[model samples]
Target: MPFYDIYSEDVRCGRGASKSGEETKTAEVFAGDEVGFVVGRSAMEPLEPHLIYHNGPGQVYLSQSTAADVREYEGDGNWFKISYHGPTNDSWWSTRDQTGMNFTIPDSTPPGQYLLRVEHLYVRYPIGTTQFYIACAQINVRPPRNGTVGAKTPSPEYMVRFPGGLAVPEYMYEWPNTRLTEYKPPGPALWTG
Candidate 1:
């Protein structure tokens, strides 16, 4: 029955607001058990429609994945509704509240870290739809008493390589104080000077 919080970093309320980035919160839970988490408003205002839904908004997705085998659970394929403030609803204006749903992790799932992807989408007219933002969470599920699973390898570091040799540093050559007429070209004795 461990609890966690999920919220957006830069919540905005307008049509032209940017919707490119998202933040994810992760937790560890046991297999064959229900992992309870909360998604609500951290501030006094709920996530508005104009900010998220430019055209037509749809139900937010709570996707789950695992490192081991994929097994079906009781609430695995179900879609839950999250109540939102309609455009015309004035009774509960500017109040930050949340509705929640319960889902159970499958007992047949493997004992390893699983990923849960949460995305917000909108369906617009003329065009089909697009995902505005996406966030993810990792859950470590323990194996059953008699079950065994393998561990995961760490991710590799990202690097960039230049095609040619490294870029040459810029150098500035300045001539000493001498008139063009007074300057004489270097001869074979230039190295001796």
Candidate 2:
């Protein structure tokens, strides 16, 4: 995992904490495989536990990408929101006290290289919820066991950039005291294929 060390905190309060990933070494996965990333440090919980991916050319080397910037691509949308973990009626937050956030690769996902992004917006921090922590890992997804399922090309509305993708909700401004009866992770909805 290419996670910037916790000691790197002094580097701008947790924005863009990506430690460059490996080019040759990549996590191999098949469609429908449940993959996850553990938080680098225990003190960190994957708030909003937003997991998204971008299938780009070459190592898919990108720290951030917006829908507009991705339109130039040849096929599926650049970034796809695979999953989002948030608070529930019974739990304060879904990602609390868990090994990590797990998401199944949609069966229709094309077999190729992609950038898996795990990000968390630290809500209760000296810096506030806007404090963003992000890490990108390289993975090579193989064909689904059933066969090559036709993948759907996600629309531009289904993609979002990292830094600007998560827009802080109005309730989070006064966080710690914000009455969050329902916490929805900010970003486009998950693109389930």
Candidate 3:
């Protein structure tokens, strides 16, 4: 496997960014908060630009076996509803540095621990190729509540679980050598109920 690096940080959650394996949390806020992620990369060689998709919604409905079955879905478009904020090209260096991406959890987004899967791909030449995985960060989106500067806001009791667990898979496509490499991120640091 070639050396590919993936790094991410939560903008809403104030924390100095670090390589994958570092654990972080978001600031306690209302249920419907617009959260963003600052994702960057460093690799031995320039990598081809790939698509980043949030498979959260699909995970909410699919079963564990079904979720892991990437073949069941047809391309990134089928697996996730993607929204790009960066350059859309086939160049590998597009994501080589710090790139900012934002995702707003619906006001109706249940308050609980959510798994945000980040998938990288080079989708201009041979369909889906060039892949990498980033460490999953825990986001604790609090619920609405009344306050008088010190009143405690009760946390909602909603549970959000990723269909195939939180361990993201890492695979790569080296043209002639196409192989699926299992990449495991750091373990879950904290648990929410």
Candidate 4:
């Protein structure tokens, strides 16, 4: 895999193909199962403190558009529907520094095509001044074998928008007094159903 510029809104594996993606068929996992991806970081290190800090990383459901437009989902917010998040690990500084990160899809997730959005935050400046790196993986989800469709899916309340969901002043500002234990990933609450 090659390094993708964070600001370009390009699909991680697009490789200059197209920002929206080529409707390629990737992996298919059950609606409620474990999925994972390996994160790769640039060989070069950032010179600044915040740029070098690898504290928070997680995955979000970018969107569930058609087969051709699965990559249309991008950006940060409640609508992004973050499904899994890993807290800061003292052992690693960047996502690329880690391997085999995994998260589970909510059992109630709607069955469809999706773009799994993975992101890592390098907290260098202040609490709110964090930089983010994001990538997307194409996935197809099928209704469980039991043949019950939409019976265990999430409710509307589970749907959240990012910037609006995490618009609190405190969320943007982090200080030494902040309690790491009380930390919550930025976005709507996780949909555990």
Please report, as a residue range, the 10-residue window in candidate 1 with the lowest summed lDDT: 160-169
**Residue clash pairs of candidate 4:** 41-96, 50-124, 77-161, 77-162, 78-160, 78-161, 78-162, 79-160, 79-161, 108-153
Off by over 4 Å in 1: 1-26, 41-98, 128-133, 144-193
lDDT tens string, model 1, 45-164? Answer: 556522332221122212234224222211122121212222222121111232322345544444554443333322222221222333334555665444543332221221111111
Give per-residue lDDT, candidate 2, residue 139: 65
Q: What CA root-mean-square deviation does each model show from the true structure?
A: 25.5, 9.3, 14.0, 6.4
What count of clashes does model 4 give? Answer: 10
| Candidate 4 local lDDT, 3-32, one digit each (tens) | 224334343323343444555455786766
Candidate 2: TM-score?
0.62
The residue-by-residue lDDT of candidate 3 on 90-189, one tens digit each, is: 2222333334455554444334443344433332223232233333343444453432122222232222222222332232223222222222222221
lDDT of 2 at 50: 35
RMSD score of candidate 2 (Å): 9.3
The predicted structure with the larger lDDT, 2 or 3, is 2
TM-score, every prediction: 0.32, 0.62, 0.36, 0.62
What would the per-residue lDDT of candidate 2 be over residues 1-193, giving only the tens digit for each residue?
2223333432221333232332225577787778777656433535654332210001111112222322222122246677676554322455544545677888877666666666654543233324444545556677787776875556677765433323344554453334444455666767777
Local distance difference test scores for all models = 0.28, 0.49, 0.30, 0.51
Better of 3 and 4 by TM-score: 4
